[model samples]
Target: MIVLFIVLGGLLWLISLLLFAFSAWASYKLMRLLWGKIRRALLRPGTAQITSYEVFTPDPEDIHVQDTRPQIRLELDCERHGQRFQVSLGPLTCEELFPALDLPAHHIACWLSDEDWRQLLEKRWVTIACDWRLRKAILTSQIRNDRRLLLISFLSLSLFALTVTLSLLPH
Candidate 1:
């Protein structure tokens, strides 16, 4: 009778350990899922259109290549409100801006080769949150939604970490 009781208790402990491990793994997976969704949402970004764009090509003859680096000046027009602003950015290749964004081969190729910057800017609407300086002007209702999602994701991650830490502690 004593031997049977000990065996049953050991089995229960092993099962609980397995359950705990599984829950931790599941939480991690959930966190990753949330992040993927958030990234995808950011890929399209906010409601803004580029009315005009200027690409400043550096002169090879210029000695100060650092200062005369390839820059793009964009005239952003917010669709939500009739707000207009100018944003200056460096060359934004598909590989640079959306490195993790899984775009089609043709789209990536077009973005890389397009001299006029049409493929990236003129073709579609972009997020007004192009530069940090313009954050105050651009951050509207969309920012709130993004913040809520981020908060939830962080909380989930923190909970997962705490669970793992507590589980690792000596019983």
Candidate 2:
């Protein structure tokens, strides 16, 4: 009886260790995601006029870079707090998270629609959400679906965690 009790306890301890490792990984990923958002929020928001942009599509004929997506290169003139600067950003790539199965279209952030891409090209202006401290600039357009996708990711992760927790309980 004592031996059986010890074996059960060891199994439970092993399971707990696995759970701890998984939880730590999840927390690390969450923290990294949240930290990026916080950093972006803290930065001063500014819009940079897209002075010029060039779209580069990798040669489909070349096997070397055929699988690569299109890249957008931009020259931006940004002004913030009476200080104006010109910066170049690219080759920017966008991919949507949940892409439609039927379409062959390339997406930025895995969600940017064909129409949005067209407008971005035609409008010749983009919102510059940049981190000056990092010397990096991110050009973005508003998309409602982006937020929905983020929510979905969180919910899915939470659901997975719940499932694991439930399975660990005595049945």
Candidate 3:
């Protein structure tokens, strides 16, 4: 009877460990998949159109013509062209665009200009080859990390199970 209890407890513990390890692996895989999609979007040749644009201000009134200074202007350039267009962007939207453009959020504002904005608007096909190339690199790194995590988890779980099973056998 004591042996039976010991074996059952050990099995339950092993199962729980396996479950946790798998969950972590799944999380890593999901992150990698998302990173892949982002990389593709960024790296594909041609300008991605400016699908949308926004300007965000904590106080709407701050954006009013009467206001002397605005905190920052956010632009959403979906197209890869160097055209000019007016688009509004909020802080959150800026964050979302960073991964898509493969550029740091801080650098985005610097790239904005009247001529560039006009070009972006005029260029129907915005080539984002540079962005895409950078994205590809990032995705590759993510995939490598995910693979490493999976390998580690599988090995740990196997070793643990083996140890438990051997311990339970007659010596």
Candidate 4:
């Protein structure tokens, strides 16, 4: 009976480890993808006049405070020959918390060029370039943050599984 319990515990541990490893691998790939996106945004630096901005909030998980920022997608009328495009800016993270704890919607803190900000507030249609540095910073921040959250969740789950398994063993 003791040997059976031990074998089961080992199996559980192995399963948890496998899950952690897979998630870590996924996170690494995602980080690389995000880095590539940042490089592309920097390289392109497309010009467009703002039509409007659409806010897209992902299913707000109470994952962590840092993961709470909503994504803002820009609707633009491109400059060269008046082509229209919806350019992705940043899924920006912010320092401030949402006003209500129950509310999933809140503002995010992110960097933007002064001119772009003013134009954003005034709702003026002005030609704008992709703010390469700010976009890169936002992407980097999100990559690091999501990885951190994944690790934390994995650790917590592993700990819980260990505790439950050990307690069930006939000591």
Q: Order of candidates by TM-score, top first?
A: 2, 1, 4, 3
Candidate 1 minimal-lDDT segment of 10 residues? 96-105
Go through the candidates in order and give the C-alpha RMSD of each one to the true structure: 14.6, 9.7, 11.8, 14.0
Better TM-score candidate (1, 3) = 1
Estimate the TM-score of every prediction: 0.33, 0.47, 0.29, 0.30
lDDT of each: 0.55, 0.62, 0.49, 0.49
- Give the Å error, residue 97, model 4: 21
Q: What are the per-residue Cα lDDT tens digits for candidate 3 across 65-166?
A: 442222333332433355434333333333334444555555446345656544534433322333422221222233345556666867999999999999
| Model 3 lDDT at residue 29 | 100
Model 4 weakest 10-residue run by lDDT:
94-103
> Candidate 4 on 37-151: residue-level lDDT in tens?
5444444333444456555456666556445335455444443335344444433333211111112433433344546444542343422444333332223333445556666
Cα deviation of 120 in candidate 2 (Å)?
13
Error of 1 at 139 (Å): 13
Write down the lDDT that model 3 would get: 0.49
Tens digit per residue, CA lDDT, model 1, 65-91: 653434555556543345455554335
The digit string of per-residue lDDT tens for model 2 on 1-171 reads 999999999999999999999999999999898767656555554566767667667788887774467666777777766866777777655442111111344544434455665555553655565555565665433223334556687899999999999999999
Which regions of candidate 1 are displaced past 4 Å?
Answer: 1-44, 56-73, 79-84, 94-124, 127-161, 164-171
Residue 47 in model 4: lDDT: 40
Comparing 2 and 4 on TM-score, the stronger one: 2
